[model samples]
Target chain A: MSSSAHGGAPTGQGRAAALDPKREVQRFDLHQRLQHGLMASSFITLVVTGWPLTTHGIGSSQSLVELFGGMEATALIHRVAGVCMAVAAIYHVAYLGYLARARRLRFSMLPGPKDAADLVGNLMYFLGRQKHRPKFPRYTYFEKFDYWAVFWGVAIMVGSGLLRWYPDATTSIFPPFVYEIGLHAHADEALLASLAIFVWHFYNVHLRPQIFPMSWVFITGRMTVEELKEEHGAEYDEMMSELERSRPKTPAPAGVPAEAPPAPEDAGGAKP
Target chain B: MRVLPPTGPGFFPLLGGKPRATLILTTLLLAPFGTGHASGPASAPTTAPTAGKAGPLPDGALAADGFTGSEKIAPPDADPLRDARWCRLCHDDDHFESSAWRTTAHTEQVCRDCHSGYHFNPHLPAELGPEAATTNEGATPAKRRAAAWATCQPCHKDAVPEEGIRHGLPEPGKPAAENPPTCRDCHGDPHEVLLSKSLPPVERRRKMNDRCVACHGDAERMKAAGLDDHVPAAYGHSVHGRKLDLGGERAPGCVDCHGSHETKDLKDPEVGRATCGECHEHATPDFVTLGDHRPFTLEARPVSFFTLKFFGWLTFLTIFALSMHVLLDVYRSVRVIMAANRNDDTPGGHA
Candidate 1:
């Protein structure tokens, strides 16, 4: 396939014209997309099943309870949702480990000095103290924070929930009071995490300016060239530079049969 | 006297006898006084006896002066001198006459030991005027005794001592303010004081449990007692406490597991699940076999306690960190917008 098919948007024009159609390359693959879909669905199910018990009152909770068929039904749904989440988590870990072993994965979304600098620089810019936007790497500080938060939230909720689910077994190896403390911590933390997702994460990714409708990166797994440049200028520049360096040298047009096109074996193997 | 009737000698013999006539007239004249004497001393006064004399009397004599001439009339079946009121009458002296006066905790205390001089009768009707009754008129006698027992504060007022107030039973030398168990509060009847240890097991348990809930059930008191506000509420809803309230025979109570007069502090290692297990055999065994319910100490049950605690803390910390991360994400987005705005304002600043 031509580079245009993978690196740029399609158009009726020839490949040369298609190469500059103002779109960035895909960031997430099929596996990543499937994982994200499962995570989202399972999390939504968990919230629906679990939140009624926490916000127990006479109103909406009663209807929810009935919807689930009763309190026992609600509990059963919660447990089932918990199992689904647990399975999803296990699959995620295995997949991540596989990817890491194969050197196909890199944690590019971790926070570093660049993120801190971005925060301060952006704050100054907001206060009218700066004249330029801060440059960002492959991921902005917020995206890095979001990514890390999901991992942390998943780790906590699954770990605590499992301990609670098998309290008798846990107590066999641990003190009973530990279970009580675990119960309290798990419940309160879940509440905090869920609220934060609803209020802060949702607002940033879906309600902020310019991204008012939604951030299509999560849905489409791709971003436009302008969006990549605006949000991750440094990363875009580095990627462009790398692409230019790796481009194959063009041969003379229709003359001398291109000098045998330099034996196919001598070209740098093949592009990924 | 004429002797002309000598003809009917034998018939007229005693008809003229002076000794027999004299005897009959004398017996007739003394009948009223004799009957009065046979009825015991006709000098005892009868009215509701005053407080000092209303209980069992210690000495057999009139200790007070007011009834000296009123005839000490002991009922045919009862001894007047041994009567509680009779003793109080003569020994009407406040310093020593009152029956409850010589009790250990309230020696020299008058009739108002815990009664507040109102609603002194345990059987008083529930709807009596409030001012004329103790504050807890509608409460059970046991509960009233518990609340009013605090009346010991009038004289022995001070916060109850620490060691004494730590557990179910009052500690020795506990001040009235702190350990104010009135005479009747713990002892039942002011007139029927007995050694706590000597009481029947069942009676002792019931009385002790009754007193505990008096302070425990009170939200304010429980808060002051360093317990969770929800403890009482939880206990009230618990199977044990509920069954007790419903009068279930098998239900455990505060004193059923905890000792009546010698209740120990919950912190005592020896007093943990073992103590609770005394009566709750099932619960205790479950706790021990399952290794639940026992207090975790670093030196004692380290591995078990720490494992659970570690998971708990880890879970909590992770959630907290995630929440913070989400919040920071929001902040970063806001910053991004602000940065974009600034960049737009600057010429040729587009990335």
Candidate 2:
């Protein structure tokens, strides 16, 4: 249900103070936005086109098949979308590898022990069992879960989908049941992924009261300071401390504790 | 062994030599699939379930001109069905066969060709129909139907294969009263067999399936014929059947998977997959697990069975839990929002 899975991952091109120097802070980069865009389009295409053929054995009707003009045409469109998704996945992996090479990648989005504690604490606060909300770091557990789901979902879908697409080649290497398993897994995983995106991701990212309409961080790749403080208070505190050090000769921005002199006109604006 | 079917927009089998080709060519050339089967006198208990269903013709069926090629017999106006007398002068008023004989694939054939058994001279009229009430032929017309059925074996020798006589016609020795149904039951009146050449593949398939449904869909008729009525019910709910019901052009009809001159060679699962693979490329033997209208259960359809259960449960449980989380989050968020709003309204501790 997280809107900004990749958005929370810092680019390391600039720190948060250098990102905007204005009221807004950078949450996602252009690359992250593009990747999300690709994933979103291809995933939607695959689900719409694939659901009919995958569920052809059941309640899937002629209208579904006819929606894409028939089985042959639907199949063709499914293949094209499959290829696009496969490419998008490869592109993501390659980008991650490049980030690792540049030593710019951080493991903040990875799951850690604190995430479980945070989830329990957050739920307690929601249930009025606690006085305060749980403090969140750069990425929440939900965002991490959304990220890893795509990672796992893409692997399973692409692997099983390839096996199904080339059944003759697949069956030659493995048994017929292997192909059948691929078919089963492909269809089931699609349903699971679709549900996760529609219900969980949509609610957290777009439908939740706090993020209703949308979380514009996905589009603008930035969140305002007040929103950053509210949503990711831990990250905001850390960035404010860094901002404090960076502007030792100047004053802190308003709403942040001013521990230094008045600010200079030319701030460290790295064009966030 | 079953004959590997001839593939094309084929009506007759494209089995080896010149004769089969000639037959198909003539059938197609005749612009077959005439709109209406000439109105035979009513009260044949064996007709299709819907009356006048066979009356709906395929496109371009009636061109006023039929086969006039040098290869076959040509009437004066090149219209074989409307040809005058030797036969139609008296037969048109008496029999349903003469009026629409050209709509049938047997358009090239004349009267004595099928009737010559009763007549010694080819040109002489065979004493037939109501006028021949005193003759032995007219006294027992049911005998004439059996004789007419016997005439089909020669030209349509490939149709009644050793493998496929399981459904319609019984053994030759069985009397007319004992016979379950002959060719006319499924194929419409003997004179008009709803020429397949004139129909597009899907319409042809749909019309062919309509005939199958005629006999099989009727539970009472199937039971009377000592056949189970399960097939019609099962097939009607099948993916193929549903597509056909929804007017899909490429949907498999009764004979697409099951062979024509319909029978049950689909017992073998490999054969079943092969039939499915006609349209679905790379259809493994694993795919046809639901063959023969088997229930969609674990035993019959293990993969799909497990897929349904697993995915069904997963979707339900995941959505349910997530929805609960969302609701509690919403209620808590709303409460927090309200509390903050009250404090702001008072500009103090109104909370």
Candidate 3:
């Protein structure tokens, strides 16, 4: 019944105090969180303006058109939103490069034999095929699958959208039919992505019994210490060991005097 | 009453033979007069001849006999088989030979019915000098032949009743103009009334479009009709019309979409949707939810708002999820790489 059991920590300043001895790990920073929020809102605007023209009748299209301030307004908003998505994608790629050069980037989201085993093992556990809990790494097979799907979705939507936006230019390089094909792919893939999010991603992140309301990690970009231990045990162990190794050899060097006594008593005192 | 009889001889003896002669003469004269009066009172009244009734032949009229009549009769000229008597002597067939006369609204009228002054046969041909005939003729010989149709307007003065405004006849007080659309304008030929039923479906359908375009294609006339002035121009450029002009039979002509005999205006709600759907079979309730005939543009609104709204919301939710996924992936990947680098730098760091 603890917050960490659902993969989140309590809010605000109390969050730090709520961290138990087994909890305490950092995942996303402020810049990444800001980019994510902007990208999400822009993508929403793009879908709102674009999808109505694709699936709905003209009457329905008009309201969406009016929402963006008439047909021209809708198109303009969509283009601007597309630019926003592109900027977000560019920032993500740049951020990855920075992380790689700094030796901070991780490949934990990549699929492996262990993830495959986890999938079968978790299915077995759910079906009452096994009595023991399945061992998991920092990212489960589902989480990895979700992560990879986004990259593929973004690549498809953005690539097709850009081609459609500059159709004449695209046709000059490719055939006119190519632009038409791109348009088709763009719309159909968008529909697929939308459905997948509703059925799969939404259920996993928000509607599941373990996380009935929502997973707040997307909003706050933090996880409790107990959450790190239970869901990302291996990562949690590695982080703690690194923290210990990085600690000063002695209590104080003269001027700095070691910030405060190691608060081992506070650790593991509260359930996050 | 006195009984004379045989004893009248006594009275006769007194008056002598003179009295007997006088009585005989008077009786004879009075008997004739009395009989005439009696018959006049018993005889039936005879009715006068009515208008258009057959009357006795005039004195100058030709008789069946070979005697020379008041008017000089020439020997039967021209082919006897094709003589005026061949057709006209029995029936008033002159009216039938005029352009479109038989096909016209006035088909029931007789020759004398309209041409009161012109007598049939033995009459001189309508006098026309070569110069005068040429001056009166139309732009072409065919048009000149069409002039015969004008004879109908004397009785059928108003030809275009459907046209709200009259244009050919002169103003109320002015003299009549020469521009009236004679029977030939619509009926084409008096002798050959084109029966609509006789035409095949394809020709009948094509004629419908032609009839509409006849007036509609004229920019000035269409403007006068209070219709879309750009119709002719726009239709010419449209894919359907252009294809038809290029000889594509499959292309939809005006009547192919609009009905032929039962053509209704585009504004009629019942016909509008059906007309558009005639070609676009996929025009579902969902497809035309916007109503038919929208201008093509980037800002053109769709027909159904609900479906659009649903997709819009769904798309936004999906993109939001995707962004979060990308963020989490970046975070996870960075952490993994950093952990690996640390392990690589330290001896036995993997343990």
Candidate 4:
């Protein structure tokens, strides 16, 4: 019922966001949005430069090399993007630390028995075997998998990348074969990461029929109350119950102060 | 066959204790142009040039002729040729080689140091042509810039080990079996031979790799010399090649495994193994046997080969399964979304 619902968002995603009601629930904070943005941009850049270097353009890397101006420019751009990705990853860790320190970190994203059951239920529902759809919490199993996959990927990529970036130093500490191993890990993981991003991540966020064109939630960092109820019924119920408990005992505006504590759902990116 | 050397006193440098030593070196340089270099040994002729050719050697007598060893003489404060401004007076068109040389270690060297045959007098039509590494033709056989060999050989004469020397190696330009690996053939033109000392070690290796790739990359060129043509193409696919392609310049290039001049050592498996040990301390015999190129075959490295195969399958399957899940989810979500849109006749209802 808020008049200012979904009124203003920085990202210009009007086409997809027109259907969205007032962005009521904060699914991600500004910091989380920033992390996603950095990862997304740097991941695209790494993929663009990396594929050519991996396949050698199926025979000759000349065309791709020329596309980026030359081999040197391609290399410089790839490394710069790599550094951006590394910084983004490190920043995410720091963000997590800040959250944990503030006692605001939630375990909803962590996989549990319910997540497994929901995944099975969702599959059964999708196949028409189940009468009712699965009820999801704050984070779905797929989202958690996506998040954790990024963590694993960043660790593998950056770890192996540093070894390649400074081979002499790497060889001095570790054996030569270790550098070779890093080579394989860096190349193979890149392919896997690229595939996951292009297929799994893209399909979930952009290519799916219901979410076709794109998911502006990545940019707006918010979801409508109705969307929250439909997609994450359990989370909506939890927030509603918390709101009920925290509701003012006094009914009249004259008795109670005009200022009320922020709603429980606002905890995602709540004002300090 | 050659232009008579200019024996002017103006041509001579002001001398030190080694007066005749410098003259002998200049005459030795001149001898290769007109004398028997192909038919005879690399050593200079006994007879001295005219007194005009004789100059006071500012460098030690052997320094000009002594192309061997790593004698790195720094360029003088106002080295005229350091910027190639002086060389551009007549030879202006070939600025590429000059520009490249300006940044190289040999900024101190003048055009005349290597081009000992060119004189103050008018040159012949043949003399004006570029010193290319080509087949020995006509009555005069050693058509390659004999001066380039004289300039380079003295400094790097000992580069090929005594036993490893293939005097008539039949290099790229001069494909005849009797021809040696002319410094021109590998280094391109003598002027642009970049002793890229200022470059990072990896960059220098990469530059040298270009020279190796020039001949080896060309199937016809390699075939003419009876070398395997596929080696260069195969190397581009190898892990080492991929590393280089990824801008890991430190990866082993052609010269890193096979010596620049001592390529004969590659024929010996033991020599290749020893070279492998030089860089890779733990290189196995089987690994060393991968030769100049083929490094990633199943027989060479079954474990790594399998590992790559495993990753390929994993990537394909994971993506496929994830994609199917998304598809199935979307198939249901579309119906659910449409049903919700039907229930709610709002203009903003999602499709």
Candidate 5:
């Protein structure tokens, strides 16, 4: 295991990993990570400030409200968080437009026919019907679902939240009921989103046995070679082929080896 | 429940629920609680009673410039209920002690219906009768006083202690000081049950508005009870109140909108529509579909409830399915990780 795993893994087709020793694959670009960081911070702020109001006196909500000065202060902080979220959402839209204009727009994160197939394949693997797991691409169906869910969540929450924030103006244009609906939608959706993050998203990204404490991929924006190979093998293969095509153009001038030593033939990439 | 003429405004064949049922059942329920009979226009007020001057002069007498000489007008009837003179025989003419009945809507009602303890003993003169001696067997004066509300509750059954508005009734075994106001505290004395229906409709509404505002207006009381302080004032300034002030006969009063007996908080979503429906029978659906009683908050609308319920179920289902998926995914991932770890630890194994 150590021999084949640490050294260059040579396949039957003679496909080999080229020279990088670190074996670190960039999963998220700086722009995407910054957006994620902003969103995460804004969301946290919102939950901290707004949750006290939502739950009122339940649990530590009262203490939390007191900690933030008073209801008025807490509300002000919530508004600030709301503004932050708005900025992040707007930035994301602008980023999408930039991507479109630059002609580098990729719909890899968008769900497609392959995602459906992958979901079924993954379920089969989970049930032990398939010996090998599905080879995920740059974005799995789960990650796509998260992305779209956020899009939907942000739209509803922001629309309703803004209406609630400016009720006097809202009621002027719309019926009183519209303002009321805004409050309900904003509050209820916030709770649902918060709970989803704490439960489902948290487990997948952090609390799962494999990840345990957390996966630092959001912060580091990189994945280990094994992780890239196992979880996102298809993306890893694409990256490798791209690297192979480009490697000759950027060769070292000195006596450095171009590629690592290949695994022994006896290893055969066999399982225990 | 008012008596519905075969085709009166109060009766609608299309109307549904308790109001319609109450109207239908009025004939059956009317005879027993004689106070609220759905009969014709209520009886006319008789000439104000001029009782024996030997008793303390009624409070209003001092306010009057002078007293007219008592003419020997025959009493209306020998009915014990209607005659304030009967009560004045033993009781003084304080605010509601005896002759004050002449000033209120209850001049037509029997005193015995409300004040159950004091009874007639014909052997003695009406004034010197054993009013105290002939008591309600076991009930103390306070208990009898408290129980007297039982008489009002039969007609105003909606405002029972549990199901009605939060009137701050003391919990059982609590001190009497914590007890909510009895009927008399708000309605004034039973003998002089401050009736406004006999007045002009505008005056009636104004009088009711005042009474409702009395309790709801008390900021300290409302705060102590954890009730909304702005509600009474808000209601007074609402479209209904304004309409009523303009003498809109169809306009709703406090008792009309908030049931006298079974009053709930106006913000209660479940009751808001039905309460509005009592008057705006045709427009109830629209009112309900577009209504939001949380005038203070913009977080709610008629559609809000549906959205909330829908999202609540959606959240539950989504979380449930996702959690299951997560568990399965985790199990598989953990197994893969463990296998990889085992292979890594092995001396002569592969990746």
Candidate 6:
């Protein structure tokens, strides 16, 4: 994989080396991979510790609580996990701001008109109604959905959870009912987020036929050139065209050996 | 070789589980019982005595016609001419408890309604053998008790309530004997049952309180029932019990919170809101929705129930759709792989 910053093709000498047809391509950069890792760990922790409290008094839930050394300890772990999620959310926003200022923000992750068409095209192919696959860019609609789902989930869970965690203080500003509503939203959204990750995201990233047993892209932040060709052909083609456009070309004025026309002072100068 | 029950002085063993303090208090209050009558706040008839030969009114009032000189209101549906004379024959103080029975609300009922075999003379002859005494028809102690309890079920619908809780019934197939609560445990003997409403307001409240506490306050008994031993003390100290102690009519007692017969686990989400709603009707919906209770599980709260249902369906749909998509993709991939494999197996199929 390209180990350069911005996850784009390396320039100059490294570019020539990457021109090989079988080279690997950078997908997620270091910052992005770290953000994903943080989110994943925090989410798992929250689901583990929070589920028992949500289903308190049940035999299984009580046993889980005991396993964690009682409700107090489990609750403490849940709150700590919640705080980590909040930190990850804050860090992600900062990272986004940094990208936006740097003019390096890739709008490919944003949903567009093409996504709907691609979804239909992909479905048609899956249904055996078509032969050619729906050529995707860097980010497919599924990936974008997964990305935004986390953002939405974090907003809901953090907002509601704060009220529930500090109800005494929150109740002073908001009515008691607000706190309850917040808790409901928090807990319900948590379950939804957890299921989506385990089913949708897991299936797409790790459990798909070819990727069974896991995909190392999450850890390596890289995809092979074959994968880029198969999965993100449009992105690969666009990058190739840009590279061609930016290549240095020899100037006509450098070869002034034969009869050459002299440029006129008043008219636009013509050179051989 | 019979074992004597552990009890304080003058403790009434007839009530199987009354605490020592409660028994002492009952004895103190019933000190006048030696006079052949229970004299207390409950003894006073609610209505004044009539001036002429007349029967007692159901509400204990003298007939209005006697004082106002107007047409008398018809008495209740009780048959004044019912032959219960045979009941008094064998049930007089000489053979049984007849004093309290005469004063009970059940005076209107004939003896046969309860003791089904009482109408006939079932007494064995004096020359009967000892084995014949034990083998008498319809005379087993267990059978008699079962018949008497069965007679109560029609009127008292939930004779043994909260069947789901089993009210401390033994686990199926276990050797342990469970002391399940029965009707007599709270209401006392059916023959001489005194209605709580018949007592004065204070006495009525105290009677209801004491009736429930008699069994619930026994720490060992509560533990055996898999119930909270501290429940009686907790109720006694709560705002409801405290206010009842202060003679406030608004305060709810034990029966009001945990129902008299239909007592269920308060851990139920709906029970909390519903029980509280009886008094704070307006606040019930808000109280229930507001999640005052913690660790709300799917079965407990309506919100959780609906939330779980929504997520459960959503999860099912999402998984089904995604799985179908993945399976189709896998199928297509496998078909291509097989096709490629076949092509390679054929002669001249180059890489």
TM-scores, chain A, per candidate: 0.80, 0.82, 0.77, 0.83, 0.82, 0.82
Residue B200 accuracy (lDDT) in model 2: 76
User: Model 1, which residues run further than 4 Å from truth?
Assistant: A1-9, A12-21, A248-272, B1-217, B220-229, B233-350
Collision pairs in model 4: B7-B52, B7-B53, B67-B154, B67-B155, B68-B154, B68-B155
User: What TM-score would you report for chain A in candidate 3?
Assistant: 0.77
lDDT of 3 at A68: 64
Ranking by lDDT: 2, 4, 5, 6, 1, 3
Share of native interface contacts recovered by each model: 0.04, 0.29, 0.01, 0.28, 0.30, 0.14
CAPRI verdict on model 1?
incorrect
Give each model's whole-structure lDDT.
0.49, 0.58, 0.47, 0.58, 0.55, 0.54
Which model, 3 or 4, shows the larger DockQ? 4
Q: Point to the candidate with the largest DockQ.
A: 2
Candidate 2 TM-score on chain B: 0.50
lDDT of 6 by residue, B121-208 (tens): 1122332333332224444434333443456665665555435433433233322213554455567666667766677665576777
For model 2, residues B292-344, the per-residue Cα lDDT tens digits are: 66544688657667766876797688778777877878878788777778776
Superposition error at A152 for model 5 (Å): 0.8
**Best-fitting candidate, scored by TM-score:** 2
Candidate 6 wrongly placed segments (more than 4 Å): A1-16, A54-60, A168-172, A175-177, A249-272, B1-320, B345-351
Q: What does candidate 5's lDDT look like per residue over B1-351, in tens digits?
A: 011112222222233312323332443443453322122111111111222222222322211211122223223233333333333323434644424545666555554555454332111223332233223444343453346445666665654665544453425453343345556555655555665656876577767677777777777766765666676755544445544543445556776666564455556655765665555443333354333233343243336557667788988888888888887877776677777778866421112
Candidate 4 error regions (>4 Å): A1-23, A58-69, A248-272, B1-234, B238-257, B264-294, B333-351
Candidate 3 per-residue lDDT over residues B238-327, each given as its tens digit: 434443443334556665665432344556544655665665543333222222223222344222233345445756776675555444
Each candidate's DockQ score against the native complex?
Answer: 0.06, 0.22, 0.02, 0.17, 0.16, 0.10
Q: Which rank order by TM-score, best down to worst? A: 2, 4, 5, 6, 1, 3
RMSD (CA, Å), candidate 5 to true, equals 19.7
Error of 5 at B262 (Å): 20
lDDT of candidate 1 over B1-351, digit per residue (tens): 110111111222333423223333433454454422232222112222222222332222232322233344333333333333322323234433344334433433334344443221111234343332334445444344344435543553343332454332433443333443433454454444445566554455456666666665566655655544444444444334443343334556565555444456555545655765564443332243332222344654465456556755765675575456545545545666666678867433333
